[model samples]
Target chain A: MDELSLLRRIRSEVDGPERAALDRGRAALLERAGAEAGIDARAGQGVRGTRVRGMGPDAAAAVAKRRHPVRWVGLGALGAGVLTVALVATNVLGFAGWRGGAEPAAADALQAAALAAVENSDPVVAPGQYLLVETDAVYGNTTNTEAGDYVSYLTINRDKLYVPADRSDDWVWVRSFREPYASFNAEGEALAQKSYDEEVAEADGVPELLRAPDAQFYGNSTVPDFDALPRDPQQLLNYIYKVTAGGGNSADGAALGWIADTLRTGVAPADVRAALYEAAAGIPGVEITEQVANLEGSTGISIGRVESADNSRQDLIIDTQTGALIGERRVELTDEGWGFPAGTTTGFTAVRTSVVDSAPEGGTQNGQFDREGCVDKGNGNFQC
Target chain B: MSTDNEIIERSLHSAGAFAEVFDRHARTVHRYAARRLDAGAADDVMSETFLVAFERRAAFDGSADALPWLLGIATNLIKKHARLEARAWKGLVASDLGRVDIDAIEQAAARLDASATARRIGGALRRLPAGDRDALLLYAWGDLDYEGVASALGVPVGTVRSRLNRARRTLRIAIDPGAARDEEVDHGRIVSASPDSL
Candidate 1:
């Protein structure tokens, strides 16, 4: 190969900083910009003094109506749990006006899903029973070559979490990576095979056990009492904004993403799930992104909001028949930075929650084991 | 649809407009930084690069694109952590040697060959003069042409060409000295000129 290609290949394995890092950088820049614009980001009220560059009268009016000041902090304020839950709010607020409101078809689909959720039985974890949550996910993975440039492949993963009926009880998670589903280029295919081969050769493809404080997916704090959250869709959205303050890119996107996060845990009650769907219906820029979106072989309707800044769409897939949240998927609207064509699925996850009799056994594979879910009672009584 | 120059100019009046610039180039800057430094340092460099660019936007030369300007800023910030970058390169070279196990696996053989070449290139990159390295990487890793490299380095195109030629010779020899001698004789002389205008 030519020296130029060789030089490019040197240290080419490194892709861009992760989504969180890019957001942090953007947040830092915008915060400085907000300071320069004389906006009180902390107060969250800067409508009167704001001067939105290149925006015409109507666009500026929409900004004023929202009363959303430019935020300086990146999604860091949301903390890791909420950030993980929201999956990074696509499309900060100011850009939503350009996309207009939710499509009628999209609104109708969400409303239907809401009604279906209400009709379903309430989800409850009975005593002595464990909540088993399984998710299969496929997303893009990029690797650089010694020949210069980088290639992206579809990485597959499966995670199983067993949550006990008691909040304080131990939780066990099994995480595993599978072979690649596809690749954007030849190099990516080779790299994916190499990765899969190495994984199989080293660990014998055993799923590693993950122990945590609780079985909350994405490290979200304890699941909220669905009955406690406001039932009214508008009030619930407002509560979401208040709770997720200084986090995410835009208020609408964050609200929608907050709903996605809450539902994906596979624990929200029927009423709460219905309310979240109704809340999502009101979000501007909401649309039916995909009619037959498939996740782990399950097909569903993909409803999403676009983060216009980067042209990425964050989708929440809902099974219309059952009103159940199938999973979440992220799509690239345009091939700008990502080396894939438009409509490429950048990220995806399919969740399945069920009640089981007992939790799985744990070993000293990744770390110290706690006696395979055995519990100690008074007088050294052990139940294994 | 606004040109990067237009966006930067607009950002002067409406401070929030600067975010468009960040959206457009932050990843590119971060990727470049990551290639040169560790992930943590790369994040800092990416953040700092845009902050510095925003602060100095008033002095921007109104170029049609902002990537060259942003990368120039990132290159300077990376220079501040030269020691860390050198150490990373040294580590990569060391790791390459440690992988020469006689475990006869055909699957890993091709990767090993490529990895060894990459390590050699990394070592050679560390040894190159700082100016030449910057000029070469800006052109190679940055995907910038001769003029883009010149603009990123704030040097004349002529200087960029010379540095690139010198850097290429060093890399060729590092990758394979025997092939380098024959290739250099066959090709007459190395040139940095690309199809893009300088």
Candidate 2:
């Protein structure tokens, strides 16, 4: 979908609760407004600030906490993800066309995926080196506005990915934006090469490996921080739901996506990978599909969820017999008309990953003076 | 209702006049706060927003759109809540459904997909940088245009565009209809340290 429409969808979801909150909150605010103006001496009804008119902030906050409606607590913010599981499970109001399956059996499939993760030995590198993997990706889809004026393009990107020697956060990526993006013009003519080219250039400067929020970047790549991740199924599941992923995406979907993404790097420790699958099983919407998917000609068993945000289904293709993560993809089942049509392959990645002894010529060590400061004293255990 | 600027200008000399300002703009501020925060915290924030605005009326820059200015102040207060009240509000989301219609909520919940669109948006918003997300939310829910968002954010209009643009793209990646396909888009790739094992 187009950016404007997406923004509208996002706004609509938040707007309803906000408007309701408005209805409930207005009376109390007017009372505070009235009290501040000293027009309502009978402020006992709505004015509930316990601290005096001008207490210092800390004291005022303490009083506010006390006066805060006691009935409105977060069910104690339970650490077990009880609320998260309940929220996801209960809120799955069934709108997204849930397909009935032997649902509980899907959990067993996930348990098997975790066991496979435990046995997986992808790669391990010594310090001062990086892991490099390469693949071709198509990043985004098309979107149209109400007036029929549309903005959309699809990119064919060949990328080489690199990460720290250890499972550290940051690394480098080299992207090649190839020609002939899927396109059509404002007038509906085919060769909108300029628009396609602009889209490609928009991604040209994206340092492949990057961080969010701050988006701190270097010349070729960026580093990410994933240090505080949980290693247990429940906590990891809770982390995805209550911590990182919230109302927008399913906890199960996000966890599955995250696990598949992390493992795609071929760098996570086996326990972390195991925990990821175990956590993914805790999500309520999970189902195993009988269909097998082939991306870049690698075929695997498909298990997926109808990911909420776009009414699209995300399938994780796994080689169940051998326990290999072949690949993953998201397919739009409902187009909503103005976006990519239904059955459009919105995204796909076939990854070939392995660890190497050193950074490529244009990678992490390129911008710096040198790595590790290899200064040495004479002994074997030399002090550098 | 009097114009917001008029309400603020009148309140400069008369303390009681601030009530009119509250009556005029409280709902707007409350809705904006509610969009960013949970319901009960929104209530506290809504009241505190106007209360503080009233106390600072003497310093009111009356030339600007008063609601935007108020929203700006409300935005600051919400940030403070985001930081200080994170734990406080995190413990209270379950009980905030007091005013919601269970039947309507259930109806809306019908046929809910595991990866429902709203949850994805929520998840994506959480992933967004606080600065960019603030700009986008202000524009979306705070009823602010680019200038209004700029005014609310205390940044240049260009900065608001940049932040909103960044936010827009990030959210699209999460909510876009096409994202569900191309499984590769989400799996994120790097390399195995021992490719030779193959």
Candidate 3:
């Protein structure tokens, strides 16, 4: 009475009903396949007829031909329509935008003063001091590319700035405006936090407490021999950037120029300004009306703008050295959509910065800086 | 005049010809599916199994019996559909009491002391780690030799041997608890003592 025999008998008994059910299921599947084939044939006929008659193609071509004229006419009519709609929507429907109202100009000046105090104080780059730098950028137009909107943010860390060779030592703590929908209850948060803690603990010389379930060996174990480690600083930076960007690895030449620039001058590089301009140009609805250099110094360049792609006025900062983007703060536009009724009015704001430390003490803070003034700042630290 | 291989090859060229391949392998695929998953979902798995195999026919090496390749595909599909596998196991365990053919168990018990052996084997199999269970099942039920099992499980041959040996030793100790303390027992004897001894 071996396990095999017992299993065999049980299998035989159960198999009967299964076989019958399978027969019935097969019949049903064949019937469904026939029905699907019929539907596919009908769809094919419809597509072929439409293609031959050219009705659908002709209509689409006609629309394409007349689209610009229609859009221009619409834009002319939109000016009056926007005011009435904004009044009705905001006053009656209570459609408050995602952007908040402006603080006092003095408050902004005070913020600048506070930032200047931190920057000018020759503040020792601590493990977690939030660094905010400002820069100005010129964006190029790219309305034809598939990229829906030109969006960019910043990455800050200790290892990224200082540590050039140690793979084990580099760990990023936060990214600026990186996670759009990150919430406490998200499924991956615990896993992400656990990995973060483990990396931090290992770097701090604490015995790694929790090995990743899929990890082959526990703490300080070198990656397997066959696995190729990054050989250069740029490759390492690309790896970190890939992780930070969450699969959106858009580190093209222009973006790389900004990174290289940030590394060199502590200000975002000149090419980043051009790249940002290019990104802005790709967006469908926005137009850059004006670009002016607000401040020029060894630290960075800040651009004060009259209007942006969304028709909301903005002030942008571009770092000259690092080519990393520094900050973008949108001012409320007075003309409201600027002759286009459907244009967005909500303003946007962003700031990017990095701090450098010659020597860092080990805790969780060894090689990273904090990012402030990001819209979703929780714990007042950027989460890259 | 057609070569023998060419004639056999030409016969299997079309979608209809490939559908015959499906009909021939469907039962084996269904059986493997039933073993890995539950009866309720086996047909869908079988259909999908063939669909994938059909799509990948251009890549088929055409040197081996397609049954094993089909089974491999079925195994992967089962892994992807883990919830279905769990449900099938649940259904099997729940229905085991009413469905048990006592005569068969008793006969198997007489030959290999199956009733007590089954209890021991079941306990040991349950206690064995996930990797070990997978190794044992792939070897014992899937009828894959060590090399094939290793390739199927994406593990080294040494790992497969270690896992199988560990599982067999554990089952032996469970069957006769007194054997747990033995120091110099032959590994071959331990493997032979198991109810699944080949």
Winner by lDDT? 1
Stretches of candidate 2 off by over 4 Å are: A1-102, A124-130, A143-146, A164-170, A178-192, A199-227, A249-266, A308-310, A363-384, B1-198
- Candidate 3 CAPRI category: incorrect
Candidate 3, position A102, lDDT: 22
Clashes of each: 5, 49, 39
Can you tell me which runs of candidate 1 are displaced by over 4 Å? A1-101, A146-148, A198-205, A216-230, A241-251, A290-292, A306-308, A363-384, B1-198
TM-score of structure candidate 2: 0.43
- The worst-scoring run of ten residues by lDDT in candidate 3 chain A lies at A43-52
| Model 2, CA-based lDDT | 0.51
- The TM-scores, one per candidate, come to 0.50, 0.43, 0.31
CA shift of A232, model 3, Å? 55
The models' CA-based lDDT, in order, is: 0.66, 0.51, 0.36
DockQ of each: 0.24, 0.09, 0.03
- Error (Å) of candidate 3 at residue B182 is 7.6
| Chain B TM (all candidates) | 0.84, 0.72, 0.60
| lDDT at residue A146 of model 2 (Cα atoms) | 41
User: Which lDDT tens digits does candidate 1 get at residues B1-198?
Assistant: 679999798676556667778877888888888878888999899989999999899899898988988999999999899999998777674233333334566637756676777678778989999999998788777877677788888998888977877887888889887764545431322344664544
Highest DockQ, which number?
1
Off by over 4 Å in 3: A1-13, A16-384, B1-13, B80-131, B154-159, B174-198
